[model samples]
Structure formats: structure tokens, C-alpha cells
Target: VMFFLFSLAFVQGVGSYLIQAGEDGSVTDDERDALLLWFGSVSTCMLTCFRVVTGGDDWGAYYDMLQPTGTINIIIFIFFVMFSEIALLNIVTGVFVENAMKLSQPELATLAFEQRKRDLADAASLRELFHQIDLDQSGKITAREWADIVETNEKLRYRLTVMGLDIK
Candidate 1:
């Protein structure tokens, strides 16, 4: 919207310049009228800029009419085209990223829940294994118990090693 307004302003500025130049005898009345036909009023100028920006036709005529305004008009046209394209691309990218984040929210929650379930199951298994090793029912396994179990129980040793314990 801001780009549209700025482009409208550029169109109006060129129109004003051409009209004034015509009044001062630098530009002919016909040339001024031709330019003003598309940019004389705010509504026409806005519509014209919108059409040009959105790839509407008859731009060649407008470009030719703008020639009287020297290179400034050409520069303005180029700037408008580039800025509008960049702004539109940014808008599209932002929308895509926002949607992607929104869509992934449920998946992220599911992943966290699954991880928590696995942790709880692992904790239950470890508690059971600890009880089995605590032969005295002391609620804790002593180092001697751990060493004797690990030496005799290959399965327990492998489980400890897989769990990242320095059982050796």
C-alpha cells in the first residue's frame, strides 16, 4: 500500500512537472495533456500506477509520454518496479514461514510427549533393576552388590553400558 502511494506520488510529480513546463512553453500542450490523461488526478494516477505495477498493458505509451520528464521518470519507474517486487516477495515468504511454524506446533508437542513417555518407561525399568540388585531390600544397591551383579549378569552389564554407565 505504501509502495502504491509512493508510486502515485511519483506519477503526480511527473504530471505536475510536465504541466508546469507546458505553461512555461518548454513542453507542448498536447504532450502535457497526454501525460495528464493518465496522471492528472489522484484517482487516475493511483489506478495507473497500480496497473503498471501489476503488469497491465499500455505501459509503453505511458513510458513514452514520461520521456519528457528526462531520466528522473525512468529512474522512478525502475525504482518502483524493483521495490514493489521485493516487498511482494518478502510478504509471500513471511506468510509461508508463519504457516509452516503453525503447522509444526502439533508435531512438536507430539514429539515431546513421546520422549517423556520413553523417559518414564526407562525410569520404571531402572527402578526394577535397582530393586533386583539390592538383595538386602535396603532400597539401594551397594557398590559391592553392583560389582557382583555386573560381573555375573552379562545382560545387566550390557544394559548399563547401553545406558551410558561406566559399569567397568
Candidate 2:
């Protein structure tokens, strides 16, 4: 009973959050419809999970895997919900952290990306910026700097090219 109610309440929260996302970021008119469908499906699926496990206690004389009463079923459902929620929350957390980092310190992401590229470029003695350019040791960045910070090894070059990176 408590689990069912909790699932209902949690799903309600998700529904509200989805509405807020639509109104906040306001992706586009087209995305609005898809968001609705996705939220609806997720809410329905959660409800199904709650129903499937909540009433399984009386399920006797069945498959070897299923429990005689439904305690096991409920436990299994709870575990599933726990791990699924953890993974889902991690994804949400990642998105939030990315957005927050971008908003709070926009320059950091750019610098980090450039620094990574510079490191990779430097790894093979192909540093994009000359030592003089990095006078402060703060890895100088330039539009054309991206060009030199790349590898031309056939395998890597082909992989990136296949991903539409215009490696050539």
C-alpha cells in the first residue's frame, strides 16, 4: 500500500517536472507533443509496475522464480525501482551539473575542451599553440588552433570522419 502510494506520488512529481521543462527551456512546438507522450508512457509504466508487484502476495503455486506470497515480488519491484531511479537521477544530475556549470562558469567548459584538445595534440608532439603563444602557460587558444590539435592516424582519423567531423 505504501509502495503503491509512493509510486503514484513520485510519478505525479515527474509529471509536474515535465510540464515545467516544457515551459522553461521551451524547446519547440514539435517537442511539446513528444514530451507529452513520453511523460504519459513513463507514468503509465510506473503505474503498471506498482500494480504488478503490490498484489502478488497471493500468487501461490506458480513458477519457481516467483515467490509463494508476493513478498519477493514486492522486494524485486522495490529493487528495480531503486536502481532505475538511481540511474535516472544520475542522468538528471549530469544534465543539471552540465547546465549549471555552463551558466555559472561558461569559460571553464570552453577552456577545458580546448585544454583537452591541446593535451591530445601535445601528446603526439603536435601541440596546436607554440610555447610562445602559451606565454602564461595558460594554453593559448585560437580559432585555427583547433586544426593542429588533431591526429591524422588513419584509424582515428577515419573514425572521427565517419562521425561527421570533417577530419580530412
Candidate 3:
């Protein structure tokens, strides 16, 4: 939008200059009227540019009308088309992508938090199982203790199997 407004202003400024630089440092009544009709009001210029940039209106008519004015007008029209359609569109796309990433951040965080909670629960379960297997309250399971517990405890074997540990 800013680029559109700036281009409109530039075209208006050039129109004003051309009007002032006419024959005898002044324009005829008809030419003055035509120039005024083309670049007189900001609202009109803005609507024209908006329509041209959005493809809502035919730009050939505008180009044809301004073609006789000078090369500067044609160049300004090209710049307006390039900046508004290409550059501004890319900027808008970037803003949308950035917003989408921001919106998904909480979901990503939630998934990470749930994964951490499952990991902590698994660790606690493993610790409890380790304590149960550590005979003589030694806080450690010797190979003999592990073998004896696995051989004697069916429930422990089932629990270890459920926990993805092979007792064999």
C-alpha cells in the first residue's frame, strides 16, 4: 500500500512538472484540463493504481493514456506494477508464514512437554523396578541377584517384559 501511494505521488509530481513545463511555461486549457483530470485528486490516483496492481482493471488504457505524456510516466507505471505486485506480495507472504509459525509454537511446546512427562514417568518406573530387584538393600543389583530375581519372580518377569526389557 505504501509503495502504491508513493508511486501515485511520484506520478502526480511528474504530471505537475509536465503541466508546468508546457509551451510558454504554461499549458493550454485542454491540456491543463486533461492533466488535471488524470492526476488532480489523490483518491482517483490511488483507486487507479489499486485496480491496476490488483488486476481488477485493464492497465492498457492507462498505459495508452500516459504513453503520450513521456517516458517517465511509462517508467513509473512499470515500477508501480513491479513493486506492488511482486515485492509487496512477497512481503505479505513472508508475514503470513511468520504468523503461522508463531501460531504453531504452543502446539510444538505442548508436544515436547508431553514427551518429557512420558520420559520422566518411564524413568521413575525403571527406578522402582531397580529398587525391587536390589536384594539385601544394597542399592545395586549384582548379576547373581538379577538372575535369582528373574528366575523366582513371575510378576517381575512380566513387568520387565512390559517395560521392553528381555529377561532372557
Candidate 4:
């Protein structure tokens, strides 16, 4: 199900770019330009597809491609919207709901607990993780050590819920 959505997004992204080629693809006064270069194609395609799917933004570039192409392209666009925007979105929603319904509340709690336990077991001990962060072997973590840890562990930077308590 995820693969289907990913494939659809890729196709739509390419379609969006191809259709909008006449317009400046660069960031201009009115529009934000894409950042970075190498992964831009796949990233922009996915972003454009996501925007179209969610109905957040549409510059009409994709539709504009139809202006010179005539009736056949219009038909193709209709199908693209139907399958990618409507059908795929609805199917993905249904799959999510179906999966949610498969597990009971108690079962979910048990699964969550088990997953947490497994993650903790697989990770380095809290003491060891902190020791690594304290590269100079100082008992206390300085600002540099803290910054180094946060930079290296992206997950920890995002998931720091406890202020006084430390966990790896």
C-alpha cells in the first residue's frame, strides 16, 4: 500500500515538473526555490505530489501542460487525479483504519510496552551513552558535549521529552 502511494507520488512529481518546464523552476520573488541540488528531482516530485494530494497549493503548472497538448492529455490528467488523488488517498485511509481496528486498546498498550523494552535493550546503557558524549571524560557534560551529542543523534534531538532525566 505504501509502495503504491510512493510510486504514484513519483509519477505525479515528474508530471508536475515536466508540465511546468516553461515557467522558471528557480525560486523567484513570488515562489520559494528548492533548496539543495542532487536529490531535488525526487524530493520536489514527492513534495509537489503531496501538495496536490492534500490540496494545499497548486500553481496550475500541471494543468497548464494540457493547454497545448489538447484533449488526450486532459483525459490523462483526469485519470491521474482520479487514481492518484482520490482512489489512492481513500484506499490508504481505509488500510490505515483497518489496521487500527485490528488491535484492541489493551493489545496496543502491551505492544507499546514491548517495543519500548526492545528499544531500550538494543540501545547502549544510559551511563555508557553519556560517557561517549563526555569525550574528555569530564563528569559533567559541557555545552560542547551536549551539542555534539544532539548533532550526532538526530533522534535524541527530536525526542527529548524529559529535561532533568536522561535516557538513550
Q: Best candidate per TM-score, number?
A: 1
Write down the TM-score of every candidate: 0.64, 0.25, 0.56, 0.31
Model 4, position 38, has a per-residue lDDT of 13
Model 3 clashing residue pairs (backbone): none
lDDT of 2 by residue, 6-111 (tens): 4554445445555666568744554444334322454553555444344533222222222221354446545655665676679899999999987886587788
Query: In terms of lDDT, which candidate is strongest?
Result: 1
- Per-residue lDDT of 77-167 in model 3, one digit per residue for the tens? 7777787888768989999999999987778779999989987887899899889888788988999998998899999888778877886
Backbone clash count for every predicted candidate, in the order shown: 0, 1, 0, 0
User: Residue by residue across 45-75, what tens digits does model 4's lDDT show?
Assistant: 4565456556765626655533333455456
Name the weakest run of 10 consecutive residues (lDDT summed) in model 3. 23-32
Tell me the whole-model lDDT of each prediction, alpha carbons only.
Answer: 0.78, 0.49, 0.75, 0.55
Sort by TM-score, best first: what order? 1, 3, 4, 2
Root-mean-square deviation per candidate: 4.6, 22.9, 7.0, 24.1
State in Å the error of residue 39, model 4.
Answer: 17
lDDT of model 3, residue 155: 92
TM for candidate 1 is 0.64
**Can you give the lDDT of residue 53 in candidate 2?**
43
* lDDT-based ranking: 1, 3, 4, 2
Candidate 2 backbone collisions, by pair? 57-69
